[model samples]
Target: MGKRSMPEVPQTSGPHVPVLLDEVIAALSPLAGKRIVDGTFGAGGYSRALLADGAEVIAIDRDPSVLPFAEALDQEFPGQFSFVAGTFSELDDLSAGRGKIDSVVLDIGVSSMQLDEADRGFSFMRDGPLDMRMGAIGQSAADLVNTLETEALANLLYAFGEERKSRRIAQFIVAAREVAPIVTTLELARIIEKSIGRKPGDAHPATRSFQALRIAVNAEFDQLVEGLFAAERLLEEGGTLAVISFHSLEDRIVKRFFDPAKGGPAQSRHLPQVETAARRWEKIAKAIKPGSEELARNPRARSSILRSGTRTVADARPTSFEGLGMPMVRGT
Candidate 1:
């Protein structure tokens, strides 16, 4: 029998420049003996910095490609670092039996490593396969557009991408796909551009469609809700949780979770208002943005917003998954 071939693994080189590096480090306030979770350890930029500051770091990512980099860092730091290959939403499971974590930092949205690589299909600027699964698994953006009904597609585009012409775009996609499947990023981009006429000085015609597709493909918003709640559960009293979000959808979720709100309208007339205990996190700082210096260095940092909060000693009951507006999946 011939030897079976192994699937090719994506190769990543160079380091992902950590955005707002100094700000994140300052917010985290890492010290010796503190255990921290770098939830999105893309290329270990933040993880490397955290370890250098003498904290015990558990760095994690959904992309298994990052495992090699983690291994390299483990060798460099030995006893001070560990890596887990999974989404931050599974923080509780990943930290099972590990006890409380002192701090958790999440750098959300698409990483530069993913966007810069044409093969990953994250950017419309670079043509590649239509696959946009962040973890290299499950349905691709191509699959969703090719398979979903026009109404569902339109809703997804509007809700996730905040695209205004979702119905028109969805109609165009459905019509185009009937003749031929949209197999690549360029194919979809062209269809969307045709549906919605581009403005004179518009950024790219397909930007919103691509963004919508990526969000749907990866269930990015859903995972974010879960991850935030999971981080809240994992933090010890006085522990800090910091998140960097690239879009308003993500920022809104983080903002609401950190703010005080009752779970829902009174369950019944007899039941008193079930005010959610004062939020577990006390907002430490207003949303932080990259200064002109950092933005000049990395334009991608322009939309990024960083929000940090410290956990209070009062045990605020964890928000139910549904209460957080997380889309429920059978088994994610």
Candidate 2:
């Protein structure tokens, strides 16, 4: 994995609004003196809010560019906040010896900050490098598209993006890349759009393909799985874990994990008749959504779904990722 050259943070005219802000805060139920982890500290929105509510915040993000923003908050708040530059999947390591966390909040998926910046290559609306890395390091979306075989590319597009015409799109991309490597977001977007003809009321023919590519490029699903398990381990008994997922894929994973029926009775292959039970988390509330007012203000909030759970006072043994029963790309 190679890191991209840090570009100057461009002056953006608008502020990066955190989606489901009020809902996230209410679900988190931050209390003074309770330590909380803002797993995706993009633009420090949730972290700042938690700090304001008097909770000790441990803000974590993979991108180092957000460090200055978090650092500034640390200076202002002094001992109230701390920033760790790493993925939330490593929360266990980051929180080692700090005592069990009281609450953990993860606003999954790419942040507005990442999409607004053209140089980051997260959005097709802007012309930028073909990179779609959230951490800004590792093989980018371009690398995968240009190098993957037609079959692999098709599978990635279908599995990650949920594109119905993944085969056609992959064939078009593979043929186009033969002439020259796809290096920019617009070029790839055009290729996908052209392959899949626009529909009457479609927003963009390339939208789903772009999303699939970004999700694959970032390995978002894998990270989410790891982060969820890490949260289960980090949260103390009775601690809350709240997650707001922007898409069905993410929401499904969160929903299944928080469901009590998903996990079956554990049985060892050696012991054919013996069975053991495994339980880690308890669901707190049903799926939550933003109000119509929120949707009017930010259309992106329309698809967001919030789910929460509490760590139960059961055995704290680690469980297999398969046991969680979350939908994820195999071998991801």
CA lDDT of every candidate: 0.80, 0.80
In the predicted model 2, the residue pairs found to clash are none
Candidate 2 lDDT, tens digit per residue, 1-332? 12212222224413466777776677777468889988898888777777777899898899877877787778878988998889888887887777668999999988777887888888889999989888878899889989988888887777877888989999999999999999999999899889988889877878777888888877788888888878887887898998989888888777767764545575557776743356677756888898887777677777889899888987565644675544444334
How far is 151's C-alpha from truth in model 2 (Å)? 1.0
lDDT (0-100) at residue 183 of candidate 1? 89
Report the C-alpha lDDT of model 1 over 190-292, residue by residue, as the tens digit.
Answer: 8999998888998787877788889888888878888888888788689999899988878877776776453345467687755555558775688888889
C-alpha lDDT of candidate 2 relative to the true structure? 0.80
Residue 109 of candidate 1: its Cα lDDT?
Answer: 85
lDDT of 2 at 20: 70
